[model samples]
Target chain A: MLTAHKIKVFQSLDKKKFRQKYNLFLVEGNKTIKEIPNSHFKIREIFSLDPSEIPTGDFDTTKITPKDLKKISFLQHPKDSVAVCELGEEKFLANLPIQIVLDGIQDPGNLGTIIRLADWFGIPQIICSEDTVDLYNPKVIQASMGSFLRVNVVYRDLVEYLTHSDAAKIGTDMDGENLYHHKFPEKFNLILGNEGNGMRPETERLLTEKITIPRFGKSTESLNVSMATGIILGQIFSHKG
Target chain B: MLTAHKIKVFQSLDKKKFRQKYNLFLVEGNKTIKEIPNSHFKIREIFSLDPSEIPTGDFDTTKITPKDLKKISFLQHPKDSVAVCELGEEKFLANLPIQIVLDGIQDPGNLGTIIRLADWFGIPQIICSEDTVDLYNPKVIQASMGSFLRVNVVYRDLVEYLTHSDAAKIGTDMDGENLYHHKFPEKFNLILGNEGNGMRPETERLLTEKITIPRFGKSTESLNVSMATGIILGQIFSHKG
Candidate 1:
């Protein structure tokens, strides 16, 4: 029961330019949609295979067949529902206790997992280099597992942000001080780098301390960016606790 | 040039049954192939788009076009080289310090990342439930980076294995002891469960201790299985240190 015009609009939202121009992004799957009611993001509209499966909200929702849902879905196996959501306004936490800064993180899944990790450790916000993957990328949203609802992800010039920040800057590297022995300050900006390369040279220059998670075994040259983020965040939380 | 018959054999190795029947698996990408020299696994043969890109090894190497490599490759964008390697012989560590036991882990990527995490923390071996994804799945190989070369992954009945082992059994759960404060034993079995479900009820019964990474923020229901594994392993290593 989807019109051609409607399908075109839904498909366009998948791209970054369209999402930016319209200020709307797609949130697919029943599980992810359920979280929208409690989130600050406003639901613009929804298309669902089962109307009952759609969470109760004031937003306009249309019932459609699974076949019809697939036509506009970004997922290979489209979930029972897909909702269009307006981008939430960014809240600048000036005195945030701990902030995570990402430098040119290319992988959407890695970015999403880092966002989820930041949420688990109660890190309020994530500041990404402008070149990092789009915050609303479908893969990123899916991997975030609804933590995107709680964490504020803002893209900015990471070099400028780090250079101006007064909080201690911690950058992860292979040849830095051992993570286990290093003590994190009361307030710090934990910077994670790209998948292939570590932090950018410009961002690296601004770091106050460089920390390394010692490799206990051979063969692994480096940990995945997201896994490193989780391990580093875990160490920081344990230290603070 | 890859023969039509040989290409069929290589393509078949993408499946679990084919890998078991032939006792061979595919290792794609330049970075992963470089690790095979240091690994215990034997290389059957390698096909590379550029012969110069192939690492110097005792194994037989064949020059092939990128188009030919794609025909036999399991990856969407096949890497420069693909090496067909024999499965390594399993080493039975009778008194392993810390063994990671996976129960019904479905995703190849999650299993691979967990293997990488185990390697990082110096966990010697991983025991997977019989129903878990095959260790030789090409996706697993890609996600594990090259950690699959160092870590030993064995498939078995998780419940039976845990019940028979004298090592303290620690299972991760939602409502459990805070991981930050809990003490990990010198010899222990750390069990992680499926991506969607935490642990099978039967496997749950075998656990001697249940530990959790406390949720510091609201809205995040759970952590990705691999991310959780990394965080837990990080805490365990820190505790040991």
Candidate 2:
């Protein structure tokens, strides 16, 4: 049975302050919760209408009523389950051929979609600037579609990281070389910027090279940052030169 | 000056039934509203805190208080302006080298992003299945970032449109030819299915070719529909033969 005080604590997880203070985050939906068993992230508790709906795991499952579940759900339509998960240990950047570096990305959905894109292209990690949206945000978790379980996301001071990394730092910019003709370095970091404003000036200064997605039409000023990331990643992973 | 009755009517446009009944929809944000003058859509009225915020246009601008604007605004944080635009004249599909076909897309943001992608790739039109989400959804208007002005989105019976068009109908699927290796026809229709469920079985039966974005990672089952559209379009429009 869920106590009134417990519901208050669960609801507070929606905000970053509470999520950080308690060292826990919320993950919803059966598909996402089912993947928890195999990941390094620990589950503190799982609330579900039916125990069978949750994957067999060591996590404690609490039976919840639909009405009570609605009180803690962050979604418009609450799913079958909501899990309170313990944050995993911070991971440092690993040496890899291709890595995605995000600078000041504000939207939770964009961050999540980029994480999923990374998973699709088999990129093992995402390095984010400290000011980027928190990975533990519930919206990011929902949008990542459980791909967060597979990809490692690390946060650091971007200037410090970019300055130290030996890999070529490639930022997306309008005046940069055409993506079609540009030769991508085998070992490089693909950097993406903010939505409304492009990359910060300090971050832009660190790029060793820049690339642009040539526009076929003049009507659109720019593609959504997450959509642009997907397109760029697809081109990078394609068999064609 | 905004009247209470008028404010009620503007707020009502948030619902599809009311928007259709009034034959008008809301487009928020200064950036989106600025694109209105060049498009076929007619602006019935513009509401903003400052008349100067409205683009120089034939439309009438009404000065509204920020407090009053909150009542009619659909966004959690409303932009500088909102335009009540009349639905444009429905345009039939024109013969084009490439077109996008969406089957039962229920998400407003996906429809909007696909429209933006079509604009980015120079794809002039998107033909949608009858059951697809309404194009005039406020969330779609917000997400498209004004690209809706450039692309034509038409809804029709999928089976009928696919059968009637002489161009090749290409559907995205897992068992299909690898996207990099697949030869895109000069004149073809790119079909994308619903998010949770794949395309309707009837819609699948009409495709002349099938292609897939090969997965490099085993963790992700699928990409978001809009992300998939962007990736596929990037390949189709690239300089590579």
What's the CA RMSD for each of the models?
Answer: 1.6, 1.7
Residue B77's lDDT within candidate 2 is: 85
Q: What share of the true interface contacts does each candidate keep?
A: 0.65, 0.65
Model 2 residue A162 lDDT score = 92
lDDT of 2 by residue, A165-222 (tens): 9999999999999887778988999999999898899999999999999888756569
- Count clashing residue pairs per candidate: 0, 0
Docking class of 1: medium
- Give me the runs in candidate 1 sitting further than 4 Å from their true place: B56-58
Q: For model 2, state the Cα shift of residue B141 in Å.
A: 1.7
Local accuracy by lDDT, each model: 0.87, 0.88
Per-residue accuracy of model 2 over B1-241 as CA lDDT, tens digit each: 5788888888888688988888999888777788888888889889998879678677789888888779889899887888889987888867888989999999999998998898888778999998899888888877787888999989999999888999999999999999988889889999999999979999999999999999898565688899999999998877542
Tens digits of per-residue lDDT, candidate 1, A7-93, equal 888789878999888899999988889888887899988999887878777888899888889988998988889898998887777
